[model samples]
Each structure stands twice: as C-alpha cells, then as structure tokens.
Target chain A: MNTSSNDKQITDDLMPQKFSKSGMIWVGILSTICVIGAYAYYRQLRYGLGVTSMRDYVSWGIYISNFVFFVAISLVGSLITAIFRLANVAWSTPLTRIAEIIAVSAITFASLIIIVDMGRPERLYNLFAHGRLQSPIAWDVIVITTYLFISLFLLYVPLLPDLKIMNQQKNKNSAWQNKIYIFLGSFWKGNSEQVKISDKIINILCIMIIPVAFCIHTVTSWLFATTYRPGWDSTNFGAYFISGAFLVGAGGVIVAMYVFRKHYHLEKYITELHFEKMGRIAVMLSLIYLYFNINEYLVPAFKMKKSEAAHLAELFTGEFSIMFWFAIMVGMIIPIFIMLFKKGRKPLPMFITGIMIVVGAWFKRYLIVTPTLLHPFLPMQNVPDNYKHYFPSWEEWAITMGSLAGALLIVTFFVRIFPIIPIHETITEQNEKDHSK
Target chain B: MKKIIQNRYLLLFFVFSSMLFANRSFAQEDAGQEIVKLHYYNSNNSIQYLILESTLKKNKVFTPQKDKTYQIYLDSAGTNLIAKVKTDAAGKGKAFLPPTLKKIWDASPQHTFIVKAGDEEIISDFIITKAKITIDTLNLDGIKSIVATVFKFENNTWTPAKDVEMKVGIQRHGGVLSAGDEETYTTDSTGSVTAEFKKLNLPGNQKGDITLVAKVEENEFFGNLAAQKSVKWGVPTKVDTHFFEQRTLWTTRFKTPYWLLFMAYSIIIGVWGTLIYLVRQVIKIKKLGS
Candidate 1:
C-alpha cells in the first residue's frame, strides 16, 4: 500500500476497536464472575475469612496464591516495557501498551486480593497509621504501592501521543471518547520539546522501575523466605520468583498479542516474528525458572533437614505431589519442550503454551504458599482436623476467580479506551521505515 | 524522697495490710496447726533450700510444734510430695530445692507449699522469681564497680532483710552459674549491700545488653528473688550480625530498623521524586498549549 493509504489502513486497524459480540459476551461472563466474586467477598466480610477453608495452620490459602499469581503476571509490564526498552529491542514496541495494561490491571488486583485475604480489611489503614519500618509485610506494602504508581505512570506517559491522535480523529469516536481524551491527553501538542521530555521521563522510569520491580517480587519472596517454614526458608527464593514471574509475564503477553492480532486483524503489525521471539524468551525464562526449581527442591531434599523432610515428601509423593508435578510439567517443563520447536512458536501453538504457562504458574504459586504452611516445624495439632489439610472452600474459589476476572475486566476496559497497539509509535516507525526505503 | 534507704530492699511485716483484706474466703482451715511459714534460703544462689516453720496453735495462741513430723507437698495441684521433715523445737522444719520444682514451676508461677501433720494442715502461697541485682545506671566502662540489694517483708513494713545470701552473676548464652561464684554471703544488717564481681565477663555487645542477675538463693524469709537489670559494662565486646540494630532479624518483634527506614525512604524519594517531576512536566505541557 502507498503512504497515505498505508496510514489510513494502520489507523483503522490499530485504533481501539469496538467490542464485538464475542467481546461483549466475554465482558458479560467476566462481569458475572466478578459480581459473584463480589457476593462471595460480601459473605466473607459478613462471616469473616472463616467462610474460606483456611485455618490457623494453613492460614494463607488460595487468596494469597491468587495475589502472588497477580503479582507474578504483573511483572510482564516491566519485562516488555522497561527491560525491552532499555535493551533497545525494537520488535516489542507495538506490544508495549498491551503489556503495561496487563501489569497495571494485575497489580490493581494483587493489591485488592491481599486486602480480601486480610480478615479485617478496615485495618489496612493501620499499615499507614502505625507502619513499622522493619516488617517484610511493611516492605511489601511499600514496594507494591510504588510499583503500582510507576507502572501507572509508565502506562500513561506513552499513551499521551496516542490519546492526542484519538482526540483529532473526530469521525471515529463518540463525545464520551472526546471527553476522556481531553481529560487525559488534551495537553499533548506532540511538540518536539514535549516529546523530548516525555522520552526522557520514559527512559528514567524504565531504569528506575527495574530495581523496584525486582524488589517488589524479591521482597514478596522474602515474605516466605524470611520465615522458618520448611519449604519457604530458602536463599534461592528471590531469583526463583523473578524468573518464574518473567516466564508467566511473557506467556501472558503472547496470549494477549495473539488475541489482539486475531481479533483486531492487525497481522501486519503484530506478526509471526513477535510470537516466535516471545516463545524463545518464554523458554529462556522457564529454563532459568527450572534451574531455581531444582535448587529450591534438590538441595533441601539432599539434606532432609528433619523440618523440610515432610514438606519435600508431600511435594514428591504425597497429596500435593500431583499438583506440584503438574505445575512443574505444564508451567515449566511442557512449555519449555513446546517452545523449543519451530512449530510451537507459531501463534496458535504459542497461545496454547501461554495458557499452559499461565495456568501452571497459578498452581505453582498455590503450592509455594499452602504446602509449607501445612508443614510447620511444630506438629499441626490443637487446630481442627480439617486445618491439618487445606481445601479451598467455594467462597475462596469464587473470590479468587473474581479477583482474576476483575483484573481481566480492567484490561478489557482499558482496551476500550486506549488503543491496544500504540498508534503514534506504530505510525512513526512505519513512516521512518518508509522514509528509509 | 526515696533515698538510699538502708540499701535496696526493706523488709516490712504488713499485718495491717493483711488485716485490710476483710472477710476473705479460703479453701480450708488448719485444725489447730498454724499455716506453714515457708522461707526460701540461698547464699550467692549457691544452694537452694526451703525452710518450713510450723507452730502449734493451742487454744488460739501460738506454740512450738516441738518434734512433730509434717509432710510438705510442693505443687498446689497436689501431684508431688517434695519433702518430709520433723519440726524443730523452735517450730521449724526444712527441705532443699528438688528437681521436681522446675516441673511444678512450669505449670504455675505461684506455688502453693502445703505442710500437713495428721488432720491438721497449713498452706503457704508464694511466687518464685529470679533474683536480680540492680546498679545505678552508668555508662559502659572497664573495671566496673557496682552494688546490689535485697529486702525482707515483716512487721507491717519492708525492712532491710538480714542474712540474705544473694548470688551475683550474669546470664550466659547457656550454662547456669549454680556453683563457683556459689559462696554464701549475707546481705548487710540494712538489707542493702554491695558485691564487687572482679574480672567480670563482658557479653561482646559494644552497647551492652547483658543482664546482671542477683539471685537470693534459699532464704528463711524470701522464697526466691531473681532480679536483673540491663547493664552497659566493659565496652561491650560481642559483634552483632544483624544489619539493622533495631531488633535482631530473627525476632518476632515488629521494629523498623534504620536500614529498612533508609530503604523505604530511598525508594519513596526516588519514585515520588520522579513522579512529582513528571506531573510538573504534564502541567508544563498544558501551559504550552494555553
């Protein structure tokens, strides 16, 4: 296509598309899940965390696992936007907005789900009112909050130019769209100085976000690592968490990239090459995660340190053995095996690998949290017999699924306003390529 | 003014205070046997001994039990019989600290020592505590000189206890100092006296956290007093491994360490600093258009 025709095609294809029937149906289903989750949460609030099967021994059930999964998936925003940008990787540019929205949405739910875990949600203000400097819980509150805002800023700054682009396209949108654009991006002139400053700020954020991102997850790992529990006490937790987080995040992006490409029909922009690169990246991260997994289990298994023996046995051959192996196989092993092949890196196959990774990762977090709690150093006694073994009550499942649905809802709504692909960046890149030709 | 006041401890007999408690209900009354007056004795915490004094009340007047044998049960739960002794002509019988005392101590902080002869019985209620030595607060210095005190309660007022042999030592990481520094020395007539621990061992914390414990071993009066005070002495010599000094990393206590404070503030400053600047940049963008 010629230059102006190409511009027209790109704008039409890449601008925020309307929700199709399936999209509305997807929205409806997600909303229904969220409403059910909200009701479950209301019941939890009325009855307390007792509505969930979590007890004194296995106190942190699925809610913590879900929170961790959200935090883990949120790392992708940093991987794609910050790490890739700093590395000067060009191919990921079109996918930045999608990745960041996922980060922001996942983090929002990560924050919310943790509160849902708190028996007294009203006590959250106590974190600020009597916030201690030494507690890992306090460290988490600080870093996660910092990560959220930085992630928001990172999401917002790049979208200014695109927001301005949508603003000028009077024929394409409604008055509501115009109002949102004016409220968020009316100041954007696309002037050289403004772009210059925006780019500088982006560079600063990309650099600054890297450590904060590492800290948020590493400190989260410390929440478990710092404890004396059999499975959680490890020097290897930080790297282990970060690596798994990257794999899950990469998997999430591949899934999003596929959906956006197929649904919006933007094959030319989000191409086969992107999926292939992401697959390779996912495999690399999974390998790194696999190494940590071996270290996390093997050395401890080698010692059988009396404390860790039961926990390791449960993971190896007991009740959790099945889920444990499944998480390892599907989350890490199977994804690694699949993505190793050229065929597997194809969009359709890659999408399946992404699903496997994301699902497996969620179970992996559940294993990380719940199993160790069941195997405390002391005998699990005095608590009700049910406390000895944790099975998530229906309310827990609903609320966990709801928090997930809520995160997806945020991503869904973000796409409705902001372009899933960056319009201004895409056009500029295309213009640059055309000029060079 | 609470002056030096005849050393640290003043023993006072508070019959008036005991009289103030009127119309109290007790479980059972002695059938002619006066309640056992239990006195725990120790000199420099060397030997722990319990002295039991029982007087025969004949026609509601105090009289010596002469040579009657009374069995003293240790725990209030009545599970263990600690000692059997014959009362002296002066109305006193005695027993040493038994190994079972620790087991009974674990269950209840307050111990009920029961003395019985035939149908007549007398019970004494007492609390066991670590004997602690206190020094006026002073800065850490080598060759530290200090004094500690013990008091007895009798005659309605706390008076300086006499003949209290307080074992003075520091609590080590492990191993009890039951002997060696076990020599018995009586507290002065004023109930307040000083013991100089020459060649004192310093617990390596440059800012000392070592507690000097003064244990008044088995005494005829006071059961046991384990008083301890945190002292900074001898330029603390132990190296602390914790990066944050607020509380050791292993502790369950919630304390904000200087390192964490620095970390939280540093990130907050870096992040919020950049964000405020970015917000200003956004504001500048609006002004550029207007």
Candidate 2:
C-alpha cells in the first residue's frame, strides 16, 4: 500500500496539469498579439513586400535576421539532447525535453518566417513542383525539413512512456487528456523488450541527429557566405554561425529551464546543479563564439580592402556601432563575466544572463544581415532617399513580434498538454538509483 | 429600447444638422474667387535666352486682383537664382539663359527654365547647340592602343577638338552581337585621343580579327558621331574547350566525380528512409499488445 501510494504521488506530480488563471491570461494575450500579426501579414500579402520598409538596397531585412535567429536557437536541441546523450552524459536528461521542444518550435517558425520573407509566398510550392536542385534555397528547404522531422522524432520518442503513463490514470485526467495520451502513445507497454527496443531506437536517433543538425546550420550559413557581399563573404561564416548558434541555444535552454522549474515548481527535479552545469556550458560556448567573432572581424579589418572598409567602419564606429557593441557586450562578454563566477551560476542570475544573451543575439543577427546589405560594393545612388537608410516599419515590427509570440504560444500549448520535463525518464532514473543502492 | 431609439434619433438629427452647417461654411469660404494661374510659352527663334510667358487657362482665371508680384528665374540644379525678368500687368516675363553653362543636361539641345508667380510656376525652354563633331580612327598599325582624331566645326571651319570627350570601344566578332566597355577619353590640344587596351581586349573571329570604334554620343552640346576601323588583335576568342575540366562551386554542371550528388542523395535517402522506418516501427508497436 505504501509503495503504491508513493507511485501515485509521483505520477500526480509528473502529470500535465491544468492551466492556472495566469496561464490562461498569458495565452490570451499571446493569441491577441498573434491575431494582430496575422492581420499585419495579410496586409503585407495583399499589398506585397512594398508595405515594408525593405526596398531595392536593403532587400533582406528583419525577416531574414529573425529566420537566422530561429535557426540559431534551434541548434540547442541537438546540443543538449543528442550530443549529450551520445556523450553518455547523465546530467542533461531532465533538460532534454525542454531543449527538444525549443528546437521544434524554433525550426517551425524559422520555416514560417522564411515564407513570410518571400515576395510571392504562394509560389513556395513551386520550389517542389518545378524546383531546380541546383539552387541554394532548394538545399536549405531540404535540410530544414529533414532537421524538423528529426527534431520532432527526437521530441516524440521520449514522450511515449510519459504518454503511456498519462493514459493509465483513468479518472485523474480529463477526457481530452486521456484521448491525446492514447492517440499518441497507447502502444507503449513499458515491458522489458519494449524498453530495450525503445532504448536502441533512441540511441540510433541521437547518433543520427548530430550530423543532420550540423548540416542544417552549416547550409544555413552557406546561404550568406555564398553571396558576394563583403561582410558575408568569409570562410569563417560557417564556424562562426555554428558557434554563435550553440551559445545562443544554450542560453535559450537555460532561460527555459529556469522558467519551467520555477513556474511548474519542479525545483526538486530541475535542481541547482543543472543550472551550474548549464552555466559552465554557456560560458564555454560564449568564449568559442567570441573567438569566432574576433576571426570574422579582425582578419577583415587587417586588410581594410576598399570594399570591406566601409562595412567594417559601419560596424566599428558608424551607424551600426551601437547595436554591434550591445550585441558583443550583453550577448557574449557580460554573460561570460557573470557566468564565470560561482555565485553568478545561481538560477536567478543565470536567468537574467540567459535573457540578455538571447535578446543580444537577436540584434547580433540583425547586425549581421542588415549592415552588410546596406554597404553593397556599388554605391547607393539614384534611389529614393529613404532607400539610403533602413528602419523597420510598424508592419515589420508587428509581424516580427507576432512571430515571436506565436513561437512562445506553441511552447505554451505544448506544456499545457505534455510534460515540460520528461516524467518517464525521471522515474526511470529514480528506479535505477534505488536498484543500485 | 424606446429610450435607445429616442437617443439614436437625437444623434441622427445632430449629424444631419452639422453637415448642412458645414456645407454652408464651405461654400462661404470658396467665395467665387478666381486667381490668374501661370503657364509656359515656347519661342521658336532665340539665340541667347530661354523665354517664359505665362498664359491663363480659364476665361476668368486671370483676375489680376492685385499686383500679384511674379518672379522669373532659371531653375539651374534647383539653385533658383540664375536670372529674373519684370512683367507689366501683361503677365509677360522672359528668363535669360547662359550659352556655355556646362550644366549637365539630357541628350537634348533644348533646356527648360522656369517662372514663378504668387502660387504658380511655368516652364519654358530654348535651344542650345554645340559645334558639329567629326571622328576618324588614326593608328592602323598598333592593336595595343587606339588613336582617333576628332575635329569640331567651330569659327566657320574644321579645328582640333578641345575639351571634347569621346568613347572608344571594340565590337566583338565572337558569339552574339556585343561590344566591350566604351572607354572615355578626352581630346588633347591636338584633337587626337588615344585609348589604351590590354592584349585581346575584345573577342575576335577564328582568324583573330576585331573592329575598333571611336564614338562621341549626343550630349547637351554635341550631336553623336562614330568612326570604326578593323584591327587584328592577339589570341583567338576562348571557346568551351576545357569547360568540363574546370570545376567551380558556382557552376551547377555535373562533375565526373559525382561525389557531391551521390552524398546528397545518400543523406536524403538514409535520413528519410530511416525516418519512415522509425514511424512504421512505432505503428507496428501498436500490434504488440493486441
């Protein structure tokens, strides 16, 4: 009777809970923002990209930058769930599910924002119907789709046992919850043979995902590096992008772990040790990204080629300087300084640094995309004066914010139905410890 | 419901009343006032000036309600201070333009100047022409540099062209009809200009032949003129002799190695094949309990 009660208590604590009033209000606000964004996008679709401030010179703007940011942050799922698992690291198990969810949501929106960036999004299907395999865009579409499915599988495979557990507590959960669990994972029996097969499948997926993840981000960096633009034309872009991506992704995971821990009151499961480990990881990644940043800028500045000089000047001391400095300090440097200290690795301070890294990384993407485009080799001439400079219009701001809110809403709904922290995995770990003792 | 209907009726009454009063004020502000507007008048014969004569469009348009002071000025690069003229109530004004202004103009001898009155401005143009241009290719021996002698009809006869710039180009013989970049060269005191070109500057026929051309395009002052001569350049035009061997990242042509294509296909097949298999395995698990 005592063992059964303890199991029931564990089940209740790990099960997906109903949304509190605050959660409902948060969802409502996000939905409203999404609706507004949808309306703004509809206007853009009707009127064409002309409604946005993007013109001939600054053809690629916030949309491309946002897409890059999404792709960058999406890399964390592979870093945490796949790489860690393949490395046989045990500490990352509790955080795996959060990382995977972020990857799925971010990549989904990464694909969406790309469609939004296109002038004729209706013709997006044409990429498949009469596509040229030679195009870089075709390559991106292929890899992102592959990465998305792999991410989804990585997310879903782990949730099966949890889904099965949810299906068991017949009376405790609502009818909708029971139906979802059944539809998703009624096949999960938790038998030794089944567990053996599941473990083998997960191990294979974890191994398979590492290269696919690298390919997705490497191809994304090639989209810019292949261009003739001075800032984008560099051998360092792929490694630079990958490193920066890992840093921001780790930052994102830290941010999410803190939120899920505090809000869901899963402090017992997501302990301070996870924060310390993640904080150390974040610092290391920030340092790697910082090195790449130096290589990306320093080598170019040394040459000061006539074409590259203008672009470097713009980033160094001209109009984009403020954003450049902000991104460097808040995104990489400050977080590095803070996370280096033991005291700074505490959850609250790490959360603050995580948010800073994320926000700074977004502007860093902006700095990467827009400033380079503004300094094309040919001088800007014979265009409208407004085309001389770029600032995101109200419609752009609304759509960008809306896309962000939409991603959050996805994570929100995901947590509402599925466990943010993996219940079955936690239980398995607890069982293993007891047996070992 | 009854009170709401009463309030709606009251709102409609005020709305209708306000519109009526608004229309009355709009009509009062209009006041049947007519102002004389300005227009441009073209002059066929003029030597030293561009004329601007304002004409009224409507029958009662030119009220001449007061002095209604008008100003006549040439709009040179928008400086708006070239020259002005006075008109005595006849609404007539003339703007004098410089003959050798050298302001960059379109490919037209006629240039437009403007006249501004109280609220209206009129544009009028006059003809400004340059001396006749004549070009001739000089150096027939050397293919490295082209020397073309140009002369202008000034002071009644042919003279060495001074301060006249012309473009030198080569019409390519290979492939479709196209020309190389036209290098601009200004005539020296001797009216002879030389264009320096690298060896094989323009593509030629199988016999290494190409045509050199010297041209002066129609500018604000000079009408267009061109002269051409044949020259045998260096090597034969490059063909697709080694296209297959030359591999570059930019080209999408299939490589003999077939490695990239094979690798891409393998990754696609392997990843998606494994994915489909995993999904099927998940489905097969449902049969386990049954």
Candidate 3:
C-alpha cells in the first residue's frame, strides 16, 4: 500500500467503535458486579470490618491480597510502555495504550482497596497527620502516590496527538465527545516544535517511571519483608515480588491483547508474532520468578528453623497446601510448561496460559500474606478457633470481585471513548514502514 | 363457623396473656435476686468508710448494676440515716461515715452497719477499738531487720495486742514489697513481728534512702494501723529524663533522625522537582500550541 492509503487504513481501523451486543452484555454484567460490590462496601462501612472474616490473626486478608495483586499487575505499564520504549523495541507501540490503561486502572483500585481494608476509613488522615518517616507504610504511601501521578502523565502525554486526531474526525464522535476531545487536546497543534517538546517530555517521563515503578512494588514488598514474621522476613523479597509482578503484568497484557484483537477485528494489527514474542518474555519471567520462589522457600525449608518451620509446613503440607501447590503448579509451572512450545505460543493457548498465570499470581499473593500471619512467632494462644483459620466472607468476595470488575469496566469505558490503539503513533509508524519500503 | 372462630380467638387470647405474664414473672424473679455486699473500713484511726456493692446475675455471669441507689444506716433498726449513695459503673458506692454520727459512735462499744437497696438489706457489726503501730529498724552485723509492734487500748490501759497478723515490707510506689520471702507475719506474745531485709542492690533515690513500712490491715479489733521509717539501705542510681529528646527512629515525627530526614527529603525533593518540571514543560507545550 502507498503511504497515504496505509495512513488512511490505519486511521480507519484504529478509530474507537460502538459496542456490539456482547459488548453491551459484558458491560452490563460488569456494572451489576460493581453495584453489588458498592453495596458490600456500604455494608462494610455501616457495620465494620467485622462484616468480613478477618480477625486479629488473619488481619491482612484477601483485601490485602487484592491490593498486592493490583499493585503487581500495574507494573505492566512500566514494563511494556516505559521499558520497551526506552529499549527501542518498536513492536511494543501497539500494546502501549493497553498496558497504560491496565496500569492506571489497577493502581487506582490498589489505592481504593487499601482504604477498604482500613476498617475506619476516616482515620486515613492519621496516615498523613501522624505519619512517621521511618515506617515502611509511609514509604509505600509516598511511592504509590508518586507512581500513580507519573503513570497518568505518561499515559496522557502520548495520547495528545491521538486526541488531536479524534478532535479532527468530528463525524466519528458526537458533539459532547468532540468537546471533551477539544478540552483535553486542543492545545496540540501538531507543529514541529510541539512534537519535539512532546517527544522530549515523554522520554523524560519514560526514564523517570522505571525507578518509580520499581520503588512502588519494592516498597510494597517491604511492607511484608520489614516485619519479623517467619515467611515474610526475607532478604530476597524485593526481587521476588518484582519478578512475580512483571510476570503477572505481562500475562495481563497478553490477555487484554487477545481479547481486544479478536473483538476489534485487529488481527492485522496485533498479529501472531506479538503473541509469540510475549510468550518468550513470559517464559523467561516465569523462570526468573520460579528461581525467586525457590529461593524464598527452599532455603528456609532446608533450615527448618523453628521460627519458619510452622509457616513453611502450613504452606507445604498443612492448611494452605492446596492453594500453595495450585499457585505454584498453575501460576508458574504449567504456564512455563505450556508457553515453552511453539504451538502453545499461538493466540488461543497463550490466552489460556495468561489466564492461568493471572489467577495463580492472585492466590500467590494471598498465600504470601495470610499463612505467615497465621503462624506468628508467638503461638496462637487464647484466640477464637475462627481466628486460627481464614476464609473470606461474602462481603470480601463481593468487594474483591467488584474491584476486578471495576478495573475491567475502566478498561472497557476507556476503549469505548478513545481508541484503544494509539491512532497517531500507529499511522506514524506505518508511514515510516511504507517510506522505508 | 362463627362459634369455632370465637373459640379460636379465646384460645389465642389465653396463650398471648400467659406468655406476657411468664416474661413479667421472670423479670420479677431476676429483680428479686440482686446481691448487696457491705464493707467497713477505718484507716489510720481517723477516717471511717462504708462501701456498698450491688450486682445482678444474668446468663450465669455477674454484671454490675450501675446507678443503683443504696441507703446506709448506723443501726439494725435502720433509723439513724448516715448516708445515701449511688453505684457507679463498677457497681460500687462509697461514703465517709458522717460526723453527725460521731457522738453515737463514741458512746457505743459495738456498732452495726446496715446497707439497704430497695427491699434487700445487708448487716455487718464491728467492735469499736483503737490501735497504734510503731515501726523500728535494727542493724546487727550488716543484717538489717524491720520490727513492728501493735498495742490496743483495753480497760483504760495500753496493752500489747498478741497474735495480730500484719505485713512488714519496704514501701514501693503502688504497694509494699515483702522485706523477706514471707508475705505476712503474725505477732508474738510481745506484740512484735520482725522481718529481715533480704532485697539486695535494689535501686532507690539519689540519697539511697528507702521507706520501710509495717501495717496491721483490717483486723477485727484494730481496724487498720500503719507505721513507716526511712532508712539508707538501697543502691542509688541517677535517671536520665531527657531521653525522648534524642533523635531516633522510634521518636515522634519532629524528632526524626537527621540522616533519615536528609535522605527522605532528598528523595521527595528530587522526585517531586522532576514532576513539577515535567508539568511545567507540558504547560509550555500548550502555550506553544496556542
């Protein structure tokens, strides 16, 4: 195709489209789940955290697990958008917006889920009012907030040119939609100077986000590792958490890629090659994560140090054995096994493997948080029987499911309003390729 | 059909009335089972007090009955009213024996204390007696001992009160520490009980002075009597009161370590400064577009 025709085709293919019947039904289901979650949160507020099964022993329950999961998944934005951009990987251009939206939505809920876990949300001010500089919690607060703002700017800066395109295509959008586009991006005149400055700022943000992303997850890991608990007291926790975070984030992007590609009929854009490449990245990340998992468990298990013994036993053979083995086998081992082959790297198998990794990573976070809490250094004395075990109540499950649905809803709404694929960048890249030809 | 409906209505009325009466009767039974305890206390032969406690049993647990009123009388007949007290949240009511009853108390060798809560009453009688305790310290060959003697006024003469049980210890802030292993001691025929000081290297004030205390507590005849003596028998140590002023991790936000403050502020300033510069650059882009 000629450069002009290619640009036209790219723009036509990439413009945001109306939802289909299934899309409408999907949105309706997500909305219904969100409403139920909102009601559960309302009940939690009206009553207290007692509405959940979290007690003194299992104090950090699935809500914390959900928070960690969100934080973990959000690292994909940094991986796909920032790291790939800085490394000069041109293939990641199409997936940048997808990764950025996932990061934005996941980090947003990470913050909100923390508030839900705080039984008295009003006392949230105490975190700022009486914040101690030495507390790891304080460090987490600082880094997570900084990461959110940086991620927003990173997502927004790249979209300026696309917003200009959407603004120009007035027939494709309603009057109100055009108004929003103009309000957000009318300043983008697409002059050479403006493009130069935008590129410079985007590069600066890309560099800045890498360390902040690492800090956000590392600080989250420190929230556990800083404690003297048997399972969490590890020197390798930061690396362990970061590796797992990258794996889950990459899996999340793969899942989103397959769904958006099939739904938007973007087989021409998100091709089999992207899935194959991502499959390789997933295998490498899974192996690194597996190494960390072994380091996290094997060394301690070998020692059978009286302090870590109970915690390890609970995870390996005791109450949490089923979940532990499931997380390891499905989250890491099976995905590694499946994605190793050439056929498994195809879209359908990769999608299934992605789902497995994401689900397993969630349970891994739960096991990381809860079993250690159950096996405190101090024996479980004088506590009620229910305190010794943890199972999420209906409210916790509702709220957790609601958070997941809410994240999907955000991605869904984002796709409906703006092109999920960056139109301007895609056109620019396509023109460059055509010119080279 | 009308006759059957009338009979059913009559039966329902009987069942409902019986349930209501059953609930009322259970409540009345619970009310009748309120427990009242009366205690008399005379401290230092100067202050006399009457303490009354009220409680109710519910679900096999004794729960305090707050805001319950109780009347104290000085006689079994309940004629001489001394004080009226109300229970606090802990179900205890306390009142000092009023000066108005001093004449009646002085005229009698024995007195009856009565506390009445509604229809329930508790009576306790005590013999009026005067006693005094004197604490003495002895040092023999590097061994220190605390000796206490109790005497009671009988037949218009001061005589040693024998076989009176008392406690001899070194006085601490909240309670007394046993000078030796035994917690309590009974007086011999000479009305004296001795306890050897066994605590070694116990820290004390800068001057190394510790107060030795001896007391006869709640005796049937003596009420409560106590005596104390100060001795230089403890190891003196200086305390630093300005520890919190030091810069430490556990200190308040204001007292954060200088190094930590420097590092944290540096990161904050570095990151936020970059963010601010980026924001300004975006604004410049907007300006260029305009």
- Candidate whose TM-score is highest: 3
Top model number, lDDT: 3
Candidate 2 shows a clash count of 0
Candidate 2 local lDDT, residue A394:
79
For model 3, how big is the iRMS in angstroms? Answer: 0.9
DockQ scores for all the models shown? Answer: 0.27, 0.19, 0.60
Which model, 1 or 3, shows the larger lDDT?
3
lDDT of 3 by residue, B83-160 (tens): 889999999999888888888776654567777766567554534465677789888999989988888766656678
Error of 3 at B212 (Å): 6.1
Candidate with maximal DockQ: 3
Instruction: Record all residue pairs in model 2 with backbone atoms less than 3 Å apart, i.e. clashing.
Output: none
The residue pairs found clashing in candidate 3 are none
The digit string of per-residue lDDT tens for model 1 on B1-290 reads 35545333342235544554532422124346554677765445346566777776755888877786777776553456777888888988878767867666445433556666654565545544423233333224533534567654344344566667766656567723422344445678776645555535555366766666667655434566666556654357756546544564444336545575576788788788987897787778777765
Model 3, residue B222: distance off in Å is: 4.8
How are the candidates ranked when ordered by TM-score, highest leading? 3, 2, 1
lDDT of 1 by residue, A267-371 (tens): 999999999999899999999999999999999999999989999999999999999999999999988899999999999999999999999999999999999
